[model samples]
Target: MTDQRAPLIQRGIVDLMIAADRLRFQIEAALRPMGINLTQMSLLNHFSWQPDRAQSITELTDVMAINQPGVTKAIAALADRGLVEKIDDAEDARVKRVKITPAGLEALGQARQAAWPPVEAAFGSLDDEELAAFTSHLVKMKASLAIS
Candidate 1:
């Protein structure tokens, strides 16, 4: 029974991965013309969602699921572009926080506008019922995977 289930499990994982990769590829293509990558947009999105419009490096790592070095590098790049600021946390001098600037929000808005139409169209192609099922499944999977 275990041997029989192995191929089924592997195929299921492969199919899921392929679907996800394909969707990501489409999204990347949509965003490429706007000169923004998903990671950068994600950072801006994170700041938009944040109550204070800032996040400590430690909090970024935990919330973004990225390592310190990666977070630091991205934050530095954003800062260099005048999209974000790296500041010492008021509550903790040792903790560095990333804050999105108005420019960042504007850039993020542009990027989102460029990306969302095609991305939404891809989903729009799906039937409403199918989309709902897929969305619910994704939500369940994210929770299962501890994504947030």
Candidate 2:
């Protein structure tokens, strides 16, 4: 018997990849004029989730899809911009963690506002309910990929 599932799986994977690239391009275009790279914005979101706790590079590596070098470079850029600060780990002096500065929070807020106009215009075709459902599936896909 033919493996009918093969075409479905292959097409789904290919479509997802294409969709991801398209969405990333759109987001980058939106974020660019704000003077923030998409990498920096991603780091800011990760850091802001636990503002009090410093997030270690190792922890970020464990959970993030981005490679360590990319994370380091992005963090360095943020540091250079005064948007993030490095904190020494209490247990290990050599290890460092990152926290978003107050300025970083302000930048993040500004960036959020900056990203909206393009996103609103681009996604105008999708109603709120469709957008919500699309987001739900994306979350599920992300979680599934994380385990893989």
Candidate 3:
């Protein structure tokens, strides 16, 4: 007899990957009109949420799950667009801290407003119970994958 477990495992992995890709694509599309990609939007959101805290490139790399060069490039792009400003850390001149500019805040607000409709529509089909359960499952999954 064939092993039933193999197909189940393969299907689960493929489905998960496909679902993630589709969700990412949808989010990217929603952000494209704002002239910002999903990665930059995420960084902007981080800044918006913590306006007072200046984030270092290493901190952002860990938060964004990207490499040093990627974080540096994204920050450089945002700085070039006048959305963010970089300042040298007082304690450690070798480190640079990034802060969002007023223009960045405005753009982030606009992007969030524009992106909400699609997200609302996606969740509109779920009832309150289903939404809660889905959110709980996502939280658990994220925690499970958290780096120790």
Candidate 4:
């Protein structure tokens, strides 16, 4: 004889997957009109956030938790679209650094402005304390999961 009643256990990865899917859907919807996908937007955002830092495809792979080939493909596409430019690394000519162009910056700014209002509205019902607590918990979870 065995006990048949047991509660289903949900892991952090399951929650993360759901959240990531939702975020991707929202971002894709926001970026569709601009002819950009989530991957391109993410790269652009990274460049905007760290203007001084020179990021390579490999670096982007690690930061984005994606593969090198995918990042390379995205970079090539963005370059073709004139949204990003590849510059030779000063110290290592063999290495290429990615930088966002003026057009890319403008696009990113517009996308951020347009997307933030809706996202803010969704979360705005929460009080400041609740928001802070949620943020803190999320940060801890991310740290625990070793998600950069």
TM-score of each: 0.83, 0.84, 0.86, 0.79
Each model's lDDT? 0.82, 0.83, 0.87, 0.81
Better of 3 and 4 by lDDT: 3
Clashes of 2: 0
Off by over 4 Å in 2: 1-3
How far is each candidate from the true structure, as Cα RMSD in Å? 2.6, 2.3, 2.8, 4.0
**Where does the lowest 10-residue lDDT sum fall in candidate 1?**
49-58
lDDT of 3 by residue, 1-148 (tens): 2787988968977987887787778878998888887788889999998887888999998887888998898899999999999999999989999999999999899888877876787779999999999899889888988864
- TM-score (C-alpha, index-matched) for candidate 3: 0.86
Candidate 1 ranges with C-alpha deviation above 4 Å: 1-9
lDDT of 4 at 16: 60
| TM-score between model 1 and native | 0.83
Of models 2 and 3, which has the larger TM-score?
3
Better of 3 and 4 by TM-score: 3
Which number leads on lDDT?
3
TM-score, cand. 4 vs. native: 0.79
